[model samples]
Target: MSKTAELLKGAAEGFPDEVVTQATVRHLDLPGGAGRFALITLDNGFDHTKPTTFGPQSLTNLDAAIDQVAAEAEAGEIVGVGLTGKPFIFAVGADLKGVEVLKRREDALTIGIGGHEVFKRLSALPVPTFAYYNGAAMGGGVEVGLHCTYRTVSRSIAAFALPEVFLGLVPGWGGCTLLPNLIGADRAVTVIIENALNQNRMLSGPKVYELGIADAIFEAADFLEQSLVWTSAVLRGEIEVVRQDPDRGEAWDQAVARGRAIADEKVHGAAPAAYRALDIISQVRNGDLREGFAAEDQALADLIMGDELRSGLYAFNLVQRRAKRPVGAPDKSLARKVSKVGIVGAGLMASQLALLFVRRLEVPVVLTDIDQERVDKGVGWVHEQIDMQLLKGRINQDKANRLKAAVTGSLDKAEAFSDADFVIEAVFEEMGVKQQVFAELEAVVPEHAILATNTSSLSVTEMASKLKHPERVVGFHFFNPVAVLPLLEIVRAEQTDDASLATAFSVAKSLKKSAVLVKDAPAFVVNRILTRFMGAVLGAIDEGTPVEVADRALAPLGLPMSPVVLLDLVGPAVAHHVAGTLHKAFPDRFGTSENLGRVVEAGKRTLYVYDSGTPELDPEVAALFKVGDTVLTEEQVRARALEAIAEEIGLMLDEGVVAEAQDIDLCLITGAGWPFHLGGITPYLDREGISERVVGRRFLPVGTAGVPE
Candidate 1:
């Protein structure tokens, strides 16, 4: 009935870019035994078409608002409090940038500013509070939900977790302790730690409740009403509280004992942290819950803020947000859908994409190659997915049969792509090979069909130049494990038309993967940045930094994997090929390292001999680089590496390989393992003011630095 309540209602209705300050206030109706509750929402309401999480100040303010509701409820002025948001979502998480931006400011971990205090305050509120997780509840969002006594969720595609560890921070609030208490210690630790490394590992509502993390799940039809109704039950004590804590102490000791034994049987050894995290949980399983939580919090906090977590979190978050913009697309209203797609090669990349098209769009997909066996093998892979999905209960037998019937395999271009609405060729990297494939595909497919080439490093425009319908050809570069990696780089070229561009986005969207548009240039954007980083790593070894030491130094920088290991994963041959390609494109920028080529040509695994376990300060590498037994300092290696990478990123930005500074960061996060805590190039520049100095020197040779924009 208050003016603030009226304003709150209006805010809850939703407005773009407006932050919601307060959602609810509850008050008693005279002696009638009824109460009125005030509820509202805060959102940017961006056209992104999904619920956005809290972005800084929002979560800090939200904690205060909850306190006011709790005060009013405890004063006996209101019988209940409520929360509401539409189209399925409760707060999924706090604004990620808010937490990350701390590094930019001195002492970002200042007491109240720590933000975890908000979660603790929410959990300690006296009056019963319930969370309505209408949709995906992410890091901070899930932490806040777990703070409430009773949690309800709509039967929607929503998940819950304390995933902060993935972003270089732990579930600072009591989530680390509360989750284990609510669920079993073993399950909670395993789930928490995995998410600590990767945010996408999901723990959903129905399962969370079954594991005792959430209190209830509701059908979407009346989710909010049901949540309100549940709160009343909790307040009246109709629902009994259950506490399940199995002794984790001895159990953890036994686990470590088991892990040590298992380590002997395994290649990677006992996964020390895996056993340790669970062991600590067992140590305090039945102890004073909050006290145990505080202890656990310190333990997790110590590991969470380390260089490893920081680097990993930065890259992980960066990838999720930045790596997903379309490199090019037609205006939404003019977008076209491809009814049939063509794959020019029956190789792994093409075949993987072929399977996704059939599984995702349910459209006709054809695979063609030089031989029947190769084509059949590609088609067989799709069929294998058909049988697997049928067994997984994701699709019924009937749908699987339909999917199987929709795919085609052939050696003849006319039969494979004659009716293709879009044609994507994944062939040998040679220009002649790509041109020949496109020339034939252009003849076989209709003029309206979009011509797409899966070329990682070649010029898209040149490939299209050989085709009569050059306007239809574009680059569609997908990362390996097409089903897993969520990025699809759509390379825009000079000749690609509006219709074709629109079709590319349509295809990417249908595949449920994020699209990033990049111009067709040497190594494109992602590889350009990676080339610099990997080049620096190899260079450091030659410069006497020691190979493993240089590689390990970059690891704390938060790459997805070690640099040398990445070379192995990419295959020595391909690394050499890509490096050679870039080196040819820009001699100074991509200059080859003789030491790197040595390993590539010979296929040598171990680069340098170092102490046991640690890969740093290798004496053998010193011998190769002409250094004595004196150890190579980590600082020299790291600084040189950072300078080199910063320069390459600057070149891409200067050349407009990607149009924006953020796009450069996205490429690193998504394609390479650029850490996101730096926010992007701009933020990194802001963080390391000397980054400009580094960029200035690196770009000097490429005619980029000191040149007028």
Candidate 2:
């Protein structure tokens, strides 16, 4: 047999459970008498909820289907060949479960070579091949379309992307090579590198067409019908399909350089996938498809056997599976329906909450404050956001009107919250202020109504201590940019009942957030861990380390942003407040920096200014620091910072702040925006031996986040 057949037989010997995507073919009568065309539909025998994925058997099925279509094309039995997918999905890519089971580099190489051998057949066929992107398409799914002669897309497909680099792997099948050849190198860099690094950003259907990835765009209602007609026109010589030649000179070099800069900024050279992908894309300027394919095969084999990809797969599973079903959550049946929501403050956080509730729950959200002016401003902000969504086509005009009408402002708390089933306070962070707001709200809202606190570091139990209905209270902490961040830390207070916790989880689900059940401890999971981390860096700076050196120390760790940049985002005042709270709780481990306090007192929001699109230490902020005679190198600073993090996570586990180390990692990944290659910090700590060195044990077992023995 051939090499591809040999690899397929090997893969089947110990294949993991895979949802095989069957390529079923049927003869279609081309429109306008263009002649018979073979159309292959990719389906995994599941609903849209379960997207189709290619496994060894699935690729073999497609290979067989291609054989049938190739025979038909050669005999002139069909004018053309076309491929599409079942409702709302094309494919998501390779079944990662299959990749996880590979025991040797040869097995990994099989996946790469086998996929290329099968997909490239479309381009090699006698008749032209067309791809219809009916719905969501990702890594391998998008690459398969690149192998076709022409492609069409549905306008309503929500996600279309090549997200391989984001998962610590290059698009090994054909993506990195064919994409730049199809579109220009700059646009390919945007899809493969920039978008993937930016939290795996997805392209909308229109964006795909605009990027020239799709030849024709159609409405989802009749996408297949339109695509068939378009294909017929092309085959009958009635429509001239045109494509621009890709730039292979200075422009291609510049695009490759830009991709490298993005990868360095995002991963800081810690992960190898993006660089490997860039190398493949750069070499494709030579216009050798076979060379590009061989490079992809090598990159895939190397990455598949590496630890970063293993960690990435681990993180992906945590976010995709564990996040959906939170640990120690109450039964869904116990969750009370939140028909109406109430906000006790009308500030920015409260306004964001109002918008989120109204848009997701489709319930009336009332924002009540001390005065009508603040309430009106908050309501107006929500209305403006809805209009912006309408302008962006995320919502229609009627939906925007409904969302605007659903959010209202009121000065009377009793009148606004009497019928509200859920009331959350976004008032001041002070305990007394929150207690008073909850107390006032307790009197107005129904006794069964849930009370949530948007407290970042303060104790949820103490905030509800004086209230008569403390059992109804829960901590509903959300990260800033509420609509963007996916994490929701659901804090269960000392007196918080199961039903209250359940209702908070239910609300989080409706808001499309990943909720982690955290204990009502000081600062809780993400904040507690992050404050300790920042405290270490700040402490190093206080000892006379240069701010830039201390900031760049964590670059090797591949954090989402430097601690200094994160401080700017979190605000100096807020970071100081959280640090002080943690220091008060754990004096030796969490030390508040005098310089940070000075910066906050000076009202400096950021230590660096970006007038030239790059951060430079601000003169005013630099003058506030009082450094010691001692200094440390970046390596020492990184060591201290990581040790502090490992110790804090150990203490948190001991204190039962969260159910397990996984929850802590989940919070850091989703809430704190930690890199996935780190496996949310613990796995990184475990791999680097920091967890054992500092905490006396590994946070995760061997092979859990590293290559198996």
Candidate 3:
């Protein structure tokens, strides 16, 4: 047996039951006696929910299929070859689950080379090759199409991307090499690097066609038939496909440098995949396919064996598996149906809530405020947002009209919430104000109606304690920019009954959010840990740590946003309130900062502002801070902040605020924008030894976060 086959066989033995995307070959008769074409369909026998992925076994199968097509071409039995995917899905990329079984660098290198070997044959085939992308094609999947001679994409294709860089791995299987050669180096950098870093944004079918990635785009109703006809015509010399030659000039080098700078600013060079990807794109034009494949193999092997890749896999699994099945959530079957939703205090947050509810639930959402003017303004805001969606082509005019009509506003709470099955109050954070709102709501709301509060840090139990129907009230906390953030903390008060808790979770699901069942505690989950971490940073600043120094200290942690950056995004006033609440709850662990209050009072949106495109300390805000002689290094700042997080997470676990450490990790990942490459906060805490020092043990089992078993 060949050495590559031997390595693949060894790898395959370790992943026996991994889902293999089998390649099925069939003959397609060309129109008007043009010729016979061999069509290969890539399917995993799963629905659209399970996207096609290539593992060692799947790659081996595909290699055999390619061999068969090549043999048929040599024998003059087929004129051309075609490759496509199942309905509504081309392929997602490599099977990340298969990476979990690889324990050696040699195995990783072997698998990477094996994929390149199989895909390279597509381009080297004796006959023309075409890729019919019926739906989403991503990562390795996109690479597969690039290997084909001509490509046809369905207009219904929802996603297409090279997202390996986002998951701590570069496009290893011929992607780094072939992409730049097909598309210009500058455009390649945008697709493979910039888009991946920008939350994995994908290209639409029209965008792909516009970029010269696809030769033809057909409607979904006749996508397959039209693609087949187009392929036949191209094979018969009836149509021409032209591509612009890539430029390998100074502009290419400049584009690559720009991508590197973005990576540096975004991750502070903590993630190696981004750098490796830029390196590959920079050198793509310098080498042949063989050399490029070898480079990618080396990069993949090294990354596969790195702790960052393992951490990424852990995080991916946590999101793919654990987040979907919430740890402490009660039976979903007990959830009640919500036909109507009511929002109190129709301000920005409340208007956002009404928009989300009406659009997602397709139900009536009524907003009530203190007076007619406020209510009218809030309702008008919702309408304007819907109109913006219509203008952006996100929704049709009819859908926009329907959404606008579903959202109504009134000055009277009793009239607005009388028929609301689920009513949520986004009122003042004060206990008295929330309690009064709930009391009044309970008086008019139906007996079965559920009352929820959108408080970030207030005590849900205290607010419900004053109400006669306390059992019906639940804490439904949503982060700022409610439409974008995915987390919905469903806080269960002591008096909250199963029905109300289940309904709150149900409403969260209906709104397409990840719901974490949290106990009613001060600053429930994300805000609690965030408050503690920011408090430590603020304390260090008060003691003489420079603002930039403190902010840059956590750069190595690879958080999505920095401390001061987050503080700016989340208004300092809100942060101050949450800090005070946490200090009131756990005085020893959390300290209320007088500097925070002063900054809020001064109306400073951020401690730092942009000066000529560079971040500098705002002179007015800097004057408010009392810088001292004693200074801490970046290491000291990071340690102080992490220690605070560890201590607070320990207290939260001890108080049963969340069921386990993973929930806290999930909350931070989803709500606070923690970098997934760090495998959430707890694992990073464990890796830094702070979890052991402060919490006495690791948050997860030793090996769960890439530590040796």
The top-ranked prediction according to lDDT is 2
Candidate 2: pairs in clash: none
lDDT of 3 by residue, 261-311 (tens): 888876788889989988888877764777888889999999988777877
lDDT of 1 at 469: 72
The TM-scores, one per candidate, come to 0.76, 0.98, 0.97
Higher-scoring candidate on lDDT, 1 or 2: 2
lDDT of each: 0.62, 0.91, 0.85
Model 3 spans > 4 angstroms off: 1-4, 707-709
Backbone clash numbers for all candidates listed = 17, 0, 0
Question: Cα deviation in Å at residue 273, candidate 1?
Answer: 15
Rank candidates, TM-score, best first.
Answer: 2, 3, 1
Q: Rank the candidates by lDDT, best first.
A: 2, 3, 1
State the local distance difference test value for candidate 1: 0.62
Candidate 3 clashes between residue pairs 3 or more apart in a chain or in different chains: none
